[model samples]
Target: MFYFSVSMREVAFIKQNKEKWLNFEKTIYNNQFKNPDELSSLYIHLMNDLAYAQTYYPKSKTISYLNQLASAAFQRIYRTKREKTNRFISFWKTEVPLIVYQFRRYVLYSFLIFGLFVTIGAVSAAYDDSFVRLILGDGYVNTTLENIEKGDPVAIYKSGSNWGSFIGITLNNLYVGLLSFIYGVFGGFGTGYILMHNGIMVGAFQYFFHDQGVLWESVRGIWIHGAMEIFAIVIEGAAGLLLGASILFPKTYSRMASFKMGLKNGIKILISTFPFTFAAGFLEGFVTRYSNIMPNWLSVGIILITLSMISFYYLIYPHIVHRKLKTHVSTL
Candidate 1:
């Protein structure tokens, strides 16, 4: 009867905490806790229960169940701690690249659209003498023409102090990027309009300098920052296109759900281009102003390096990261 009473005690202990154990299991599996501190507190409580079970119910199946529960909680706590420490690094290295890879088609579409408009702008400028002025505004055209006559077609960039130029240009570029992303709400037509506006302006601006017999000079100076600046704009355009596509093609998800997903991912892509945008503005303000004095090789090198860096991040790095993840999952 003493042995029977001990067994009954163990059963009573299991019965008492059965619901609590189930709750802990659910929380662990679903990651439903509000914070790590809460999870840790629950883990500590579970450990105490586990110790009690081990001491008094050493021969019971209750011991096995409590041991498994404690083990799972410990693993979860360790994983949570590790992830918290590495979250920032993981966001850039894995999260953004994966999103870019998933939406690569949008990136291609953006490039095609922007490139087509640029071609149209160039062709229009070639045929019509007033087309450049019409697209770039008469004020800008006159100022540029005056600068060209003074043997510095890009002299407008040299107007402001380096720090002032950097801040102003950076803010303007960020505004353009934000507009490119936010305009996707109009089924992407608004984004297309923005892209067309910018693409045409760029083509016409370059053509104007080319028409003045300073094409190479303009190329040397303009491309110093334009490489990264234009590329970032194109990527932001891709994010906008992705946003529009999500609404137009919801597939298995409800339209609202799809929109939410698209907005989240599109914003992530847009955020990724910010560093490149800032670099472009910095180059435009501080470096491009000195393009006239810098050696042709130096200008070309800067352009190449900036283009390569941004290009690799958006275009090439995505594929590499995707492949690495695929291989890791396969091995697992």
Candidate 2:
């Protein structure tokens, strides 16, 4: 039997493939690949070489050089491969829902907190006449009171041109949603505060209309947009709380790593709410203005449809997608 020392084998391995390795490195650095197949072929060959090097000459500098070359080739091949799905469509269909499902507890918590604050606002307003004014601000309360007397309680929606109102309302809602997500850095208390403030205002505002004997009318108008608008806000609050929780409790990861993960996932959830927010603004600006003149059935239908659409997307659809994916993964 022939005997070959490890050092001789390592030197012979380097000598045999040194030119090919150098050429591959040049091809990668210069972006000189002819096509995806060529790049993939190079990557495969390099990986095989890497496996051989790792097994035999694990302590050699040749291993480091080949490893670097393999990494670069792999990155290039990965970047060049065509995506199998439309990224934008996939983001909405798979990515957002999965993230929402993963952190679903936060969503439930957000809804409960907001609901509790809303109840407090309604109860306080019921007991104290000044509570509405105190929460809603004197100017808004006075204007709404006058609008109530005029028998067009939601006339505020009719003030601006459709485009102007749509743009302004959309911008404001986006701002609020963003603030809710950003405030999560304060360990989620900031997000809770935003939800509380919005919930209280909504509760007080609704109670005021109820007290004035136009509860149904206000519901018809406000909820035309409020259904989607308020739901989106609650989801945004959840994203914020998720962010805070990531920092407060970095389970297996370091705090910074956990924060990055949380922020990425939280941002996805927040971005998912944008379409609903815009839809809400459109309804508020264009559709809501006609609440008084539009038939009750039509207004009610709009409210139900908008509410159902948003509710299905955020709440029900996530579970469906998650279950389907989980089942498919298990089968595989």
Candidate 3:
């Protein structure tokens, strides 16, 4: 029988192909390839060499080297294919949810801050009837008063065309969300200010309805959309706080690196709010106008569903995913 040591064959093969393999690596690393097609051609040749090594010397270092080279080339050749895949799907399905889970403390803080400010507004309005006018402005209060007399305190929502209202409101809401997120650059003060401002407005607005003996009615109507709208704002506020926390406390990472990570995660969290914002705007523009006419059960149902969806996706689902990921890593 013929006797040929694997090492002897491997040395001969490497001696023959070393230059070509090195050139291929250099071309890839230097970005000298003209296009993906040329890169793919090199990758095919490398794979053939890798296959030969695997067959002849499965447990040899040559096999390992060839396998690694082939893998790298394969990744390079199909890099664009991965990029061209459905980014939107990956973002929503994994990225955003992971971020939410990772930074849940910020979300809780935002909620507490917002709730405190709301209490301040409500207590102030309760003590002084003029507080509503002070917070909401005279014209708005007067118009709302007139609407109350007309038995439609929320009539203002019905004035605009549905589609126009949808577009305008959605844009405005998105802008506010952007503001809440970008303001994180100011060490989160700007974000906190925005949350407090919105919270006060909400508390005062609800109290205004209460003064007119329509607090329950107002809840049924406004909360149908407000549930999503306000919840998203809270989430956005959390993103801002996350940015601030990164800058304030970088921990092990360099400040710049931490800031960059924070910004990236914050943006992911911010993007996740868009669907909720759009849904809220649609509800306010179309469904809110009919609040006076819609059955109480339907309004309540919408509010519950919207709130439940937000809570489940942002709060519950994130924890579940994080736990599963931790388990997976532990097993690995």
Candidate 4:
């Protein structure tokens, strides 16, 4: 009886304690220092205890007491979770790597799209001879041709001023990339046009320099920054398409909500691309521009370093962060 029965006196005491329990809950809710995580853990333990107590003390005042406590504890736990979820969202920058790694399908899709353009560029360059002069100006082609005849296909690279060229060219290239990214949303076909234009220019540019009899010079001069800059522009276009596609193909949420989410995520990705691209342009203008005077080995080394750094930062770091997050969730 002492172990499991509910006496008349016990019932009366529970009725009074319930009012006090509600007031105590309100007080805890209002506490400025209440930690949502601590409260959630505390309440979960309490809920488990109450479940065991309910089974042992069924049909007793103890059962009634445990039921009331479990119900109230659940409300508090939910409240705490809601607050934590909001805080988690507010501090989202810390989770960017995790987010990117989690949505790795998007990353793969962006890669496949860029690879298609690159293959197209390579195939066109390999096939066409006069296509080079038609796409690159004859004046530039002739100059390059003359430079190659002199055994220096990349001689033009040795002539540019460092700071002045960097500032001017970086701004111009960034503007072009931004234009390509932002204009894609207008009709969904606009970006493909820009992409084709860029692809044609690249193919022609390479073939013209190659026809001058120094394909390696063009590769060394161009790919130093083209590697990063071109990659960023393509990714920026993917972000734009992500935004546009959300609106056109929203599945669960209202179109407006999906678009808002897509726009926010896309804008973040686009903004992040800016610094890398500007750095690429800077390297091209100041570093690659002087490659003729500089040792060929040094330019090659810088290119390798730049590619390695980009891979580590955007690819490896994000994957590591995601792995850590998964481990943490499982432990919780």
Best by lDDT: 2
* TM-score order of candidates, top first: 1, 2, 3, 4
* Candidate 4 residue 316 C-alpha distance from true site, Å: 2.6
lDDT of 4 by residue, 184-284 (tens): 56633555556666766776677666655677887777778877777677666666666666677554346776677667666766666777788897887
Candidate lDDT (C-alpha), each:
0.82, 0.85, 0.82, 0.61
- lDDT by residue (58-160, candidate 2, tens digit) is 8766665675565445445544656587878878977788778778899999999999999988999999999999998898888888998899999877997
Answer with 1 or 2, whichever has the higher lDDT.
Answer: 2
Please give the lDDT score for candidate 2. Answer: 0.85
- TM-score for candidate 2, residues paired by index: 0.75
List candidate 2 segments past 4 Å from native: 1-84
TM-score winner between 2 and 4, please give it: 2
lDDT sort, best first: 2, 1, 3, 4
lDDT of 3 by residue, 1-332 (tens): 01224577677888888888878867754677877767766776787798898788888766655654554453344333344448677577655776787688899999999999998899889998889989999998898888988998788888889999999999999999999999998889999999999999988888889878989878988898899999999999999999988899765346886799789889989999999999999999889989999888899999999999998989998877656543433332
133-244: candidate 1 lDDT, tens digit per residue: 8898888889988999999988888988999989999999999999999999878888898899999888878878888999999999989999999999999999999899
In candidate 1, position 246 carries an lDDT of 78
- What is candidate 3's TM-score against the reference? 0.74
Model 4's lDDT to the true fold? 0.61
Model 4: CA > 4 A from native: 1-93, 158-160
Clashes of 3: 0
